[model samples]
Target: MASKCGLLLFVATIQVLIVAAAVFNGIRSGYTKVPTGQFNSNIDQILLGQNSIERILWDDFQKTPELTAFFVTENPVKTIANGAFQRTPKLERLGLRGCQLTGFPNLVYVHGSLIELHMSNNLITKFTREDVHGFTKLQMLDLSRNPIASFPDMRYILPSLKTFNMQGIGFNCCLPLYQLKHPVLVIDAAPCAYPDHITDRLCLLESRFRKFRWNHRLEIKAGYSSSLGGTACQEGIFGPTCSH
Candidate 1:
């Protein structure tokens, strides 16, 4: 009876060891090479055993050629940290809607390949010329619901920009019409109000009038006063001085 009991205990110990080995092997097999392809369906396969991605290193994953579009809905990835997607040359579309980003990142490196950028519902307050300068191929830029205050320069516009939505973004100052280089298909500058009386038309008129007086003064200095029709001596109408 004693021998039978010892034998049974020995069998049970072997079974436990075998089960443990199998479980360990299964776990190791589950972490095998992740495939790469265009539009990788296994992108979110590795959850890092957590609900959100705390960190993402491309080198750790297999590369997929079809990964042109990336949609990040995870709240923990609110702001795209610097160098997050810096080396992805083939990336074309990036959607970060509802991310709590406080401002726009310097994406001049990705401007060459990025076509559509959706950053709506963010906390961006400003856009510098260098921020959008290299995106010559960009088509759609959604900056709606932000806190942008001004358009610093017009040189940042890409030739392919078709849709620009700036609605709900506060620009407490005058909207510069000259900032638009190409004909925009749609612009949601609706909520923006003209804070002053100087519309584009008024500014143009003022500029042209100043240029005319400057030319008149140059002509007068060149002995062409006959064009003044003897009114050059009129009070407060001196050459170029009338520009004031």
Candidate 2:
């Protein structure tokens, strides 16, 4: 009788241990299957392409606080739904080049930590003053190869902007070149002249445009000038009308 009781007690203990092990394994599996919302809450940077991205289903990203950088480039078939990143708080750098975007997406409500923005090679035609008002900390902006015809009011630019690239675009007149404030390193104002205008007058002045070298100052080549007679002009014309 004593031996049977001892055997029964040992079996019960072993069964309890097995049950405990099974319960722990179940908990581990459940944790592993937690949704991405809880898993990616602390993600700082995300690079997503069209194949893996469904903008409509990703509307839950507004809750994430640590998200700082985002690179979004979608295919022609995939459209980025509006309001996709309206509420991301810590977002800083955004690159959306070659995304086939027609108009500017609404990003006015994002937090003010944004520093770098690259939106080159798009089809953007218009930009309001208020579209870029909230980006106080913006340092770099690339609007190359777009269809913007003119610059908005000077006050629309962020005060802390360091580098601004608007090359390969169209500008109506020389108004933007004269209005832009200091610290503008490059302006690519080559396209600011009309067909009939004096190319030298429209050319960016070498005095106004300076090139810096290490421990030395470099002389920038001035645009061409056209003389009344057949004699070669003072400086060659710099606009499209000038003969190469």
Candidate 3:
């Protein structure tokens, strides 16, 4: 009986030691090397290469309060487990570009300190307003080269968003400009190859013009009156006359 009790205590000690080692490794991993391009003191650039499991070891991150930015691209995580960021309330920037994610992880929703999110070249189909409801400080979001057809109202929800990349989404006819509050410098608007492929997209603009709402009408009228140019509309040029 005495030996059994001693063995139990030894086993518990080993478990505690293992946990402590994991936490130490996770925190010390960031100090190995600094990432290239864009450095901020407020952000903690972490390169997670050893993590094979779906969840980020939140238990390790919680110990380091100063840690902010998470750069998990070197060894890109395939799937993020839920509650992965529960302890990481201070994390701001997250770079999961080319992680091969089909959907935004549940862990992302819990953190509110997120300001910049890089999710380019993922398998994400669409992002609704509710999916990103809590990220009030989000400024930069990259959703390039996804199958996203429907988009959330960017103007209403992500008011602070400055750079929005929807390059290869393949907008069929027209983009929903009515959903935007301010005129953002939208990249790759002519995904359908406007003017070049007239048959496919020539009448596309006309169809959008016919279905213009009150806000769209006001924008069109304002553009026509402005010194910028005539035949101006949200989807770049109004027709062949307005094509830049």
Candidate 4:
């Protein structure tokens, strides 16, 4: 009886390891070429995970030199294109939390004066050290709600970071989060927010579909995916930002 129990336990452990590896491999697949992004030359930024061409929005925004803060309420800003700062070089605060972003925005910087960046509540899944390495003066960053499998060492990358919020985040697998100081990152904290799989296999699915959008008409949670099947996934689809 003891031998049989041990054999079962070992098998379970192996299966768990296999899934974990797949999750990491998928997320790291985009890093094969060591992106010569902000880390190389006079660079600083990201964009929707897999999106390539830069899309612009709000043409009038190009002349707001005095605008200290940029925010969108119910409108839901999808991408913060490079033109967003063509005229305004000194943005002190940016609020994109709870918006519709599946990946990081490749930002071009004229100055690193941005002090507070609110990016929690979006569907951002992939993040790395280079993402924020250029935020030389960034003081606070909010990355909550997005189901990130694991966080890379953020100790020194953000030199001026005083507070980091990652509440309501996702996990690759089950986590013993009782020891976590920021209980807000708990997947079960909110009801009907993200689908059950978000908390179950967050990492495994994070990199699966890099380009996706939210269909407001559908009765589904904001970050929920339609591919999983159910009445809430009518528009499990995404293409160019304008295709919506």
Which candidate leads the pack in lDDT? Answer: 3
Q: What C-alpha lDDT do the candidate models reach, one value each?
A: 0.49, 0.53, 0.54, 0.48
Which regions of candidate 2 deviate over 4 angstroms? 1-39, 49-60, 77-82, 153-156, 174-176, 180-182, 193-244
Candidate 4 or 3, higher lDDT: 3
What's the TM-score of every candidate structure? 0.53, 0.58, 0.59, 0.47
Q: Over all chains combined, what TM-score does candidate 1 have?
A: 0.53
- Tell me, what's the RMSD of every candidate? 18.6, 14.2, 13.3, 23.2
Candidates in descending TM-score order: 3, 2, 1, 4
Q: Runs in model 4 with CA error above 4 Å?
A: 1-60, 173-244
lDDT of 2 by residue, 79-132 (tens): 444566665777888877655666666676563788888788878887766668
By TM-score, the better pick of 1 and 4 is 1
lDDT of 1 by residue, 1-244 (tens): 9999999999999988754442111112232222122223323212212124333344432343334555443233334455555546666877665656776865654778888988777778778776788788888888777777765534346777777766665444333333422244233433444453323221122432211211122221212232433323111222121211
Q: Which ten residues in a row have the lowest lDDT in candidate 1?
A: 211-220
Per residue, candidate 3 scores C-alpha lDDT tens digits across 115-208 of 8888877788868887777777888888887777657657667767787777666554344444432454354524542223332121223553
Candidate 2 TM-score, true structure as reference: 0.58
Report the error of model 3 at residue 1, Å.
69
Would you give me the overall lDDT of model 3? 0.54
lDDT of 2: 0.53
